[model samples]
Target chain A: MADRSSKRRTLRLKTPISAEDIADFRLGDVVYLDGLIYTGREGVYKRVVDEGAELPVDPAQVGNVNFHCSPAAAVREDGSYNVGAVTATASFRFAKWLDRWFEISGCKVIIGKGGMTSEAYRKHLVPQGAVYLTTVGYGTGALLGRGIKRVVAAHWLEDLGIAQAMWVFEVENFGPFLVESDLQGNSLFERANAEVAKNLDALYEGLKPPVMSRYGETDDRKDELI
Target chain B: MISTQTLQNVAEELMAKAAIEIPDDYLAGVKGMAETEEGDLSAFVLRAMLENYEAAKEDRRAMCADTGVPRWFVKLGNEARIEGGPVALEAALRRATASATHEIPLRPNRVHPLWRTDHNNNVGLNAPEIDYSFEPEANWIDLTAVHKGGLFGTDYRMLFPGDGIDGIKRFLLDTLIAFGKRGLACQPAIVGIGLGGSKDTCMVLGKQAACLRTVGNRNPDPRIAALEMELKDLGNSIGMGAMGFVGSSMVIDCHIEAGFTHTGGMPMSVHAFCLSSRRATARVHADGGIDYRTDPKWFTPYMRRETVEWQTDPASGARSA
Candidate 1:
């Protein structure tokens, strides 16, 4: 095993994080959370944002951290929840819902798989004092699961089912997330991408383009697919 | 005869194993990558992944919450007999998939394409796909379960023979760079390239190549094996690593599986087996014996046979046309 100690700045935060709490957070800093976080994605977003349904639980009570996730969870025989692992899904797909999600949920922190674009952060998150925290390895489900002290509640079981339902969790030391986007809308991934893109021309210098090109294929390597 | 009861039991166990355990081959490959990765964030991610694997084993929980879309590949021995034929075998596999989904608590990822109906189990229309292959001169059924993430890190393209290897390299780079941003591919992955066959077959072969073959395993063909090494290096040289950080750890390994295709076309597909890279295998013999392993050994000599007829040299057990 390689050295587990990370040289990057690390911070522990409590959920329902205040503006001052994340004000100093910088891109590439590590973060872990304590308190409560709720799972929500397309299903919860569609219900509350598009369908105009009210949130099942008050955001003030549940804490303002929203996780772009669905747990590997099940309903027990007695109708209790059994959550074995929890990991974040890609957050970019949920960008459309974030503006309304922030207003409705009062979410100050968004935790997910891949962070949203810097453009998205500028538009939707920064105004609401939210930052994007991306989960480590993108598959650190077991480690994250160990952080969960208990399942606080699982709403919409009948409507959205297990994977898509809103499951609130009480957690401690519950992450190994990187601060992908900070208050200034600076993105760690975009910064890294800019650096990597500089070498793309040389990497593909000798390789010839395909005989048949797909329609609308961008020649610019810096452009992101999402 | 192999009993349906035995098949189901083994299938369920294989599902749990695939979800929870990071196979030793993959673990070693990632460990090697971690040691050499220089990017600060990328190295941190790799270290975290190593810890995550241990945490998964210790807790007996799925390594990834995505748990991915669970599927099976069964290689049957020609002489093997089953209790109720292929129908029973399929049913047993399906039953095991559903039961394990609830018990192991896999995210029910499969949904109706149109209506979005969820059975709350990982089974639905054509879900938990069971792909099959056959082996010669044996009497056991090999069951391999692979749980691969359904989104991102896979692509297909049609290329002409005139384009050649350079075109293939360009496509690989394109796919890697596109999805590699923000690490959407969940990379530091095992990249598998399918170089021939019709469009669909090309896709299948690429997926199997990525999910079935262990890290450092190569194609039997010398030229193709060399290309695998070259591609692995080319991918790593992209100045990308885990979470698309600026580092040289984009690919832990590269594999290529080819099939006969239209003469004028060299249809290709690419697949990335992500960080979790979940898979497990088991063999159930006719005499009620069961053996478990991480390696599927899916690409046997028989599987890669090139001629119309397969023949084996009796003296050395070498394959001959």
Candidate 2:
């Protein structure tokens, strides 16, 4: 249980988030975003960063965008929103967009599967004061369980399919899961590194020579990359 | 001895079942998170996991699409046996392996080293992989199903492998990152990690870790418990935000499992749970007492389990997507 619902830092937008109007939100105030959090993964991200606000430009204003999510709804008839704010499934897109995505869309949350470039980390996490919270990996049903209010609007869903559709949602606190992101500029990965160092230092020392491959574009693994 | 084919079959079927009916305990775990999550981000993470649970339940597909390479670990009971399968565990495993390739439709995760798409997805060299170490007890094989999403890139995302500080942890982290990069380079998603064993087995275990159930509602392994809290913290640091962006939420979760490998060997393997994060598992008794299956209603609120929740077409074997 990391930081799920903390005071949301409010930022004025060049766009609107939903059909509903906005309220004054502070730099750090816990706010329940129930109107319309858009769903944009690989397809949507590229389109947004490339195209720049094609839709009504409503969802473009929000700070959160669930890229790793399944699908989401806007609201419940009774109002409280059948929300599904889960973890990030990131990693589908390239690292270059990491900063641009935040800069262009005003996305505070990017949910999906993996991590990003250190450059993006410093540029966004520290400067913007945004945080990423990781979720339990297999928690898809977690998204579907809260039950969706309504399929607000799915762009490219038919074309992109469920995995890459752009879904707008009226969500709850969405997570009490993993802090893959944090405004403090902290990361769950940092925590794991410390432990991995403590536990495997010896083995690492032993297998020093050959097996020590490079990461991403650095070394041997590069060959494995398609 | 239980042939590898038998083991393979059992593992495949069990995996298929998990895809179909996720346990009530797991469901309850999702409920547990939904009910009591503290941090706004963590709560959001929990809700996401539950959504995965819902997807597993209602979509009649995997919770995550990675579907991991089918793996099984058997605890043989002294009085128990494989009943009527082949001889060697390898054979049984192989047979089950083949059956699974056809029956489960699990994404043939393994690609040819050079060929890439040339993969049949399975049935390749040592396909439907199996790893086993027998206990003193003979006969009865306690088959356990485990499938984990790959957690790659996180360690590398943060650690400075090229920082010239060649530490074992750095090396291991770097190795996982390379694989993670490959996975992302292949497909960006939640990469499941497993560590322990000679360079190879640990790698297998990492994939196995995602398969290991979240300690959320189940019994806890002190080591694993510590790892969970720690991994959660470390994962975000790598800057692999929610879904690999620059946000704090990077990995969904780095579920892990370990075994007593040789004291000297610390093999770590990582399986990348692509964004699809597809996965599911099921257990059936000798009499076929099925333990669980994904409930369709679990995915769509619009769809109810009891009311008019249509089931997967039995004949075609397709669930209500």
Candidate 3:
């Protein structure tokens, strides 16, 4: 009732994020996440869904946001997990099972690099009341340097390598993340794609004939043949 | 003669530099893109990237957590005598990688592709990928190491003969668009397009172009150079912006290298590196004097062998002839 459409909000959210909190977040809204967070990726998803292994930590109780990241985090000789140190990989590869990750992990929000698929948003995300957010790609060093405050816990050390283990993080001002997918079934990626495609014709028109014709026929000629 | 000690030291320092510092040219490219980029979203992301670079350098930490697999391109002088043979040079590089793992505290990224096994030291079978080219007249060794992350799409590619320049452009554009839409490739991306060679030749050229060439360096061949500039503009026009948000600074530059192809077919390869664009260079002379370089003279093979007499401006991050 608080002018849900136009009343924009910037939230600094903590863990055990409630349904009431996620409801305020719409597609394209940027949010800063703090408190408890955890990471997973293709391998972790496979392990959870395919192998039926229990996640070492439960986001439903402790953390409400999950990150689809496979960080290159190695422990030092002291054997302590390097807290707040991580590298974020691309998120699109894990698009297929993101909804399932949300279901199993009970995380209300997810963070990754690329935007999630429209199908995932439409079918699984909307019904389940979740969102997929995107952080800046290759901004790993910066994210850890400034955003992530500490590493709380890690699990599945022996079964999954350090890269694939479940890591719970305590973050401070964790993001200016773009909400690519939301409970409303809207996706920023799908919308941005359509917007970009509208300009493709204009872009193609600017391309001159290949500098020196080598193999293929000219575009003008090809049009006639077709 | 360049001793094994010199080789190992240079390699170790280069690896540390590759992880800790973003090269000057790459930094300039990012700043340039940020300056000209439109849209508040693009501006915000680019500013964050610039800040990130500064933080990494100041903190003496890797700019990115995913310090990718260690890769080295070595130009060995034929005349230069080594304490051991080529195998010694290779061993020095391997030792440097392992040492840098603890020294620079590089994330041990080497892992078994199938078994999901992590080699904590970032060394193993064919781990630190080294490509060697022997120069007959040279008396020194020049090595450049680049860290290729998992997110930067593909490091190597092959296209059929039917894919001419038009098809090649189409492939490059399509691939960038597809991956970039997913926020992969990490724009403003640096693309290396290698054309007209066997698969391996083109792949190597592509990798070199992406990891070696600086953003503003022109290809020696005028025609190829013109294409490189054209591709840079075209790629930026796609509106992928900093992190695939709508804006103007999608690509920092596109570097292309061409070699003579088989008459029957045309092969093309593309190597894309994310904005982190981490690389470092060092030279080991026969007299045991060593020098490290901020500007990697990878394109100018002849000049790399000769004594480099260049001045660098820190403010603009530019190199003068």
lDDT string for model 2 (B1-321, tens) is 334444555566666564445455445544543454433533444455555655555644445444445555544544444546324655655555445544433434454567443243345665555544333323445555444333443332222223222333354345444443312312223334555555555655555454443323111345655665555445444433222222344344455555455554444445544334333333334343434333211111111123345443334332221
The two-chain DockQ for each candidate, comma-separated, is 0.68, 0.11, 0.29
In the predicted model 1, the residue pairs found to clash are none
Extract clashing residue pairs from model 3.
A114-B182
lDDT of 2 at B298: 15
Candidate structures ordered by TM-score, highest first: 1, 3, 2
DockQ of 3: 0.29
Q: Relative to the unseen true structure, what is the Cα RMSD of model 3?
A: 6.4
Q: List candidate 1 segments past 4 Å from native.
A: A1-6, A218-226, B314-321
Q: What is candidate 1's lDDT per residue for A1-226, written digit by digit as tens?
A: 3454546788998878888878989888888999988989999999999999999988899988889898998888998878888899988889999899889888899898889889999999999889998999977999998999999998997888887889899999998988889889989999999999999999989777678877549777776543
Give the Å error, residue A99, model 1: 1.7
Candidate 1 lDDT over residue span B222-312, tens digit each: 7999999999999999999999988888999999999999999999999999999999999999998999999999998888877887775
Off by over 4 Å in 3: A1-10, A58-61, A95-100, A206-226, B155-165, B301-321
Which of 1 and 2 is ahead in lDDT? 1
lDDT of 2 at B86: 28
Fnat, model by model in order, equals: 0.81, 0.22, 0.32
